[model samples]
Target: MTEEKIEQGTCLRCGRVATLHRGLCIDCFRKSSEIFTIPDYIDLTVCRSCGAQLKGKHWEYGGELKDIIEDEIHSSLQELSGVEVSLEDIEMRRGGEGLYHVEVRAVALFPGGGVIPTRKALTVRVKSSLCPRCSRIHGSYYEAIIQVRGSGKDLLRQEEAVDRVLERVDQIARGDPMTFVTKLVKVRGGWDIYVGRNQSARRIAQEMHRLYGGDYKVSSKLVSRREGRELKRFTYLVRLPPWRRGDYLLKDGTPHRIEGFQGRRVKLKNIETRREESVEISSVETLAHYPSKEVEMEATVLYTSEREIVIMDPVSFAEVNIKKPPGWKRRESVKVVRVDGGIYLL
Candidate 1:
């Protein structure tokens, strides 16, 4: 009889006829080998201002610290860089200042149909860094200063105009969170606003000029010299006209009502002659300012006709007859302004 040779290799676990790998059969090795790799420690950064977590180079808005810590622990674990990790349970608690300890229980599922239960204890380090917007605001930094003033404008009107301009500026700032204003100062004849970004200041100046019909001029002053170059700070001057629409001004003893601003010129209508003219605002002197409410008085209608409306001044009871403007309703009570030697119905 021929001598028989027996296969010698046996599985490490069951002693079966199987190829051995690292002293284990293929099946046993797949079941026993460690296929998961995770770090004992993880590190992440949080924004000091907005509670945003830094993921790579981007900011992730995380609502709470515990949620961020949990997410960090889950994302840091990997199953041999290819296996899928299914989390079973996670427990995290604060260890100390900016330190969190996490205990995780998960299952590693292999592509080759193997599953392993895993338990890991990880420590996370939380570092605080200012977010982009908060960093810009930390130093009270500004890129532009807008000086609002007029040559002969009324103080009250200029002040009110600044209020309107600030409202629009606030709207822009809300749209772009990076744009901000550091200070809004009440200056003579107008307001001076310090803005945080050049684009914000430019936007404000442009919108002011477009809506209110003004002009803006820009200038820069050398703030610092560095490395053979000068660092200059920008200033924007928004020049509003001296008069606004519906304002009454006395020019050369004549009452002229402001129509509106036309570029660098002011449009006005003579209250007495009923003639309209546009002129450089500086040529006229404002001997008197007539604000509508301050100048208006309650006048009772004494008589009404198609061509004329007669009114009795409540203060002096003087019967006054005036030609009515078109579309006058001839109400029993009317708003009228009397100054110097003239009376006009509003």
Candidate 2:
């Protein structure tokens, strides 16, 4: 006897004996099933000061408003199981005050077999507010103070060194948005820079000490407390060396031009003997005296020889015999420096 087989392809909605998906025909399934759900509208928070967006609980410097809106929409959608949805295109138009109408064209793929083209529309409301960083910046908040001071006797020299450090601060801020200069206050001897981040201040101080020989000290003080965490403000005191490169240093009545620096020591070349010398940066301040009588001026060359050259003194216009510097040739005008009652060709 032939067994009567049970029929199993009836759609629950249309009662059609056909191929079924989840007990429903493809047409009925597509009509009744929603692959994903998106809200009718979404609210986005933006920083009015810097154009940053607030995602979840954090503030990010994302580019452009349209790109941010697309990201928000992706996070807002809820997809059902066995369905994968991808947005193919997005069209945005301004819809009256602070509202944007977003239209998304998407494709949904079912794991077993079907691909459905879909379209979604939603409204995006943009709300402007101040971000945390912008709030702190506007309020003049600072985490560190960099004090740039020089040990030189000349005020012009001190000012020049301090200006270099100030220029460096701008470079550091480019890579790190959180690091910024809040205020610059001119003090008696040098300038004080109030910085937004503590780590940035340390970088400035380290670079300063490395290029120009100097000493720096970092001190921290308890400033405040928030959320049961202690907040501390840091102070970096940077002192440049008394003598800079190219300055004349007097060692036991002998004049030496400060050539360069190597690690913790300074390199010097004797003006009279042409001998090279090295001295610790820490001890140079005491052992070498900054030639107060040092002055550089242009002189007229009267005669030239292998080891010696004659020049007309710039001040007195009288011929003066001086030792020619190494690799120096005959020139109409020569650079000469007066140090400790002696004239030497530079």
Candidate 3:
């Protein structure tokens, strides 16, 4: 909004006429820019647990190895103070047997409002170390121990479920920055899992409840007291259900299939009556031993009727007639088990 003031001059190197500073035009000045600078050698510290980098006095959690290396090199450089430089591209690769080449592309503003692109190189040197959290974990430092246990036949079942939960939690921990498992020890009845953090152990117990119905109890030990407050390490006792889903529990003269479990309650359905009942877990206990579902025999349907269905066991070549299972069909195979010296459909 003022008068147009055009200062015309000639470039020093190319002799072009335009707005000039220090006997040079904007284009020629930009071609001869010298603001970008970096050091020859840089040292970097990378965390193995979270892959974070320590920059000067602060730790940067969102930095990759290459990016941190470039930043360290840039920080050690002696460039014009109070000027902002933009990093365009950066790369690092091994050039020879013991040498690595680091190339950093950058752009800086010239005196006459021109952008100058400059590329620089530096040697890459790295030092790796564990952060505080990971170091604590490696030192067998844990806040809680999760004990998985079951009684009677459920002991084996609980072991399987614990293995599955450990596998799944380990998969999750590979990507989760907060979770880690220190060790898994096999005991007589079940397993004991040592966890690095309390939250991670709680999460594993929650997953056990979700995948397989169970209950957990937490107990804390007072290790030390500070200012009337106690510092404690915790232990979690996770008890799996006595009867899992689809498992048949022989109570009295009836074998009831377990539907699921509620809090302190066991849900069961009669295999023949199809009646459902929920009983308190304390009121019932599993039998000494029960035939496993894996050893069941295949039964082929030979005849079907509205009142009853006849099926032939291919293993023993015996035909057993029971009330038709819902959705019964002809010439179809069904898995059946031998219980109490009688054949039953499962």
Candidate 4:
């Protein structure tokens, strides 16, 4: 005789109907066969809704309704102390339906202990903020619901944590030097130097003398300001010591280097090449009875005294006495021309 076939029923563990050949559903089978229950601490708090976790805020536990409270405590400790911590062990006492109880083990590194379990245990309460499965499917930005087991320990000591983090940050910032910006201008008798926008040319001249030591004169020129207003811009003329201009030095720290005079020989290259020549001076005695302008004239220095020099125009034999002020010397040469002015060899 042949036996009749019977319909299958749902498995009590997973609620899925069993197949004709199998007594339990696939989900129940997998759960029963797995050797380990809780894989890691992070996994224990997975939201039943979306299974998403929290980040940034230290100790923030993100996930299902069961883990919200623990995550908050974790986030708080992390912010107070610069350390990473994890839940080590968990004991689920009562679960399912509307209530649950759990004991969680936490481990973190401390200054005193290299790595150790926290002496204070954490008991959390589990509550449903969102549906475990639905919350996992769709997330909520408006509200956060969590099931806390019990109040957890304050992992970080308050004052010490704040000072330590601040000190470390300050040390890093102080390692670099500060920097600023300014403008540079070339003065009439001075080299280019830096100055602020509000600084005056006279102020810069004085500063240059203080820093480099030189005689400076300030000149003013009109410049256009905004909206067609005219404003005066001052320029400083510095009389640099001759030695400063050249590669020589004097006992009084003055520069004795003559710009146009290269030793005793007078370089007539520029004057001879020019078509027209004019002479300027402080006095007209050296240029008396001479023409106002001249063309094609040869110059020569005859004799030089402490304060004046005697020069004669080689072309016309015209003689002239050129005055040398206190700063002038006999070793200097003067250019003589038929013109009414004496052109000194700069």
Candidate 5:
């Protein structure tokens, strides 16, 4: 008589051929029998069709599993912060037997505040499934958020902040169960400078430098100017050294009292009196020699028709206007001195 071979059956869960059991396979057995441990307050439900597991009481089929996972994450966030997360409307797709694809929307709330003034949103597409026996598995294809908070006053700032937050989220999600991850695909808007004046700018720059050291850049620029015909107004640019910190005060919502000067005027003082010299000088020839009561002054900066900057003293101002200095024509660099009210030769 010929020896008979045993027929093998396959597991419905993993599709691996069964070794010892019949009907339902061992892999399927473990998956079906395994219990999912959830937190005490987390609400969970089960699929009625094949006794498969489901989460939340409102579970429905045909919806993407990724959407379900995102809902779970949002629920967890709500539990942590005690705030409800609003989800934006989006389309979801499902693939394979247990796989799903979806775009999810959610906002993060700050402590003691109703959501942030700007709405922050995250979009995620993930693939996940639950076996007929209730085994759960998930994989993310792409995930990101479109907005995040920052200290800048423009769209780029918000985008940068969102990138930073999502990167941190990714790290947490990969390491801890309490954390979740998402990708940022869009940012809503930009940041506004909280401090607007020169003093405020200095303070802000100083503080940032003190905290972050040489790792950051803090500077300010003039956005607009209103000049009268008699008083020619010019915009000033102040650049703080890297790693300095100070506050920039605001005036009527605009930055003022900033360091540095603009235009062709020298700031002078009476050496003996230690007081500011008035701009109404009687005559140019009266300023012939360095007075014993000389007050230090910075060089006046003049702009050429071509917008080139030239630095000279009040005495040489007329000469420079009439005839450009021989060496000055070939000079392309500005010499900055370190003295108080110092000179800058351009």
Candidate 6:
């Protein structure tokens, strides 16, 4: 029989004769060395009300609870250098209220090609606490107040302005949970909106000024001092213009109906000339504001001519002759607006 030859490899510890890796067998190195380390127990705090998780010093929102816990687990794990480690087959069981027992298999990929698997069991203690924002909100804390006041003569227009403020608040609150309305107080002349955050209140005021052809002013007052910092309460005053959309105004002795706003410009439709024009918002401020609920009337067309049309007033039931628009067509009914003492066809 031929003599069999035995392979010899130097293992740093056992002097084994087999495959050697870094002066040691792979199995012996794995058994003797530490692949990774993880804490035996981890603590995670959560907001009881908003379901927000506490990460470090801030509250994080908008994720599944299980995913947040997994992140916490990953954050607590420490891996060896040159070893790509990952967790697999993570199993979690609720031991009791605010307690979680977790079992996970960690796979460490060593440099140059070796895999070491380790299993660990850890306890996660879930602590429930009120986050900073939620705590302030529960205490009815407000940093700013938005005062929505309308200068228009119509109370309906003022109410509409208030409604716009409310809609804007709802939209802004969707992004930031801290941006909330603490209370809405209806006072004389307008509505007062108490906001939880000053930044959100300022944004709402600026948006109202941009869209509604109005102006806003901000003021602050020293409320108190805490933690060696001054706490100031802010107030945002949003004032709507005297004329709103669809109202009529007299520009340079001519009647013009307010159509709408376009980026700080006022769109107007001249009642007498039957012309549509856009002018600077500041220029409209010089015009005489005329707001009337009965400005628009549907009249029965009695006669039609090239430059004139006769119609029966819907309210007075009397024949009224008015200048027709350039492309005015003969129709049974015509839309007219009462300008000064004359009826004009639109």
Choose the strongest candidate by lDDT.
Answer: 2
Per-residue error at 310 for model 5, in Å? 9.3
Better of 1 and 3 by TM-score: 3
* Model 1 lDDT at residue 223: 82
Q: What is the lDDT of candidate 5?
A: 0.33
Q: Candidate 1 lDDT, tens digit per residue, 207-303?
A: 7765555567899888889999987778888888655677788777767888877555678888767899998665664357676556667788888
TM-score of candidate 4 on Cα atoms, chains taken together: 0.20
Candidate 3, which ten residues in sequence have the lowest lDDT sum? 1-10
Tell me which residue pairs clash in candidate 2: none
Each candidate structure's TM-score, on Cα atoms with residue i matched to residue i, is 0.62, 0.64, 0.71, 0.20, 0.20, 0.63
Q: State the displacement of the C-alpha of residue 170, model 2, in Å, after optimal TM-score superposition.
A: 3.9
What are the per-residue Cα lDDT tens digits for candidate 3 across 43-127?
6677777677766765556577766666676667654432347778788897654346888888765444556677888886666
Evaluate model 2: give its TM-score: 0.64
lDDT of 1: 0.73
Worst-scoring 10-residue span by lDDT in model 5 = 240-249
lDDT of 3 at 244: 69
Superposed Cα RMSD, model 3: 5.7
Give candidate 6's error at residue 324 in angstroms: 3.2
Candidate 1 vs candidate 4: the lDDT winner is: 1
Model 1 compared with the native: what TM-score? Answer: 0.62
lDDT of 4 by residue, 218-283 (tens): 556665577887665554443332221122111122211212222222111222222221212112
Ranked by TM-score, the better of candidates 2 and 4 is 2
Stretches of model 3 off by over 4 angstroms after superposition: 1-12, 15-31, 35-44, 48-51, 55-64, 70-101, 105-118, 123-129, 151-159, 164-178, 206-211, 288-292, 295-297, 325-331, 335-337
Writing each residue's lDDT as its tens digit, candidate 6 over 123-164 gives 889899998778888899999999988753557877887788
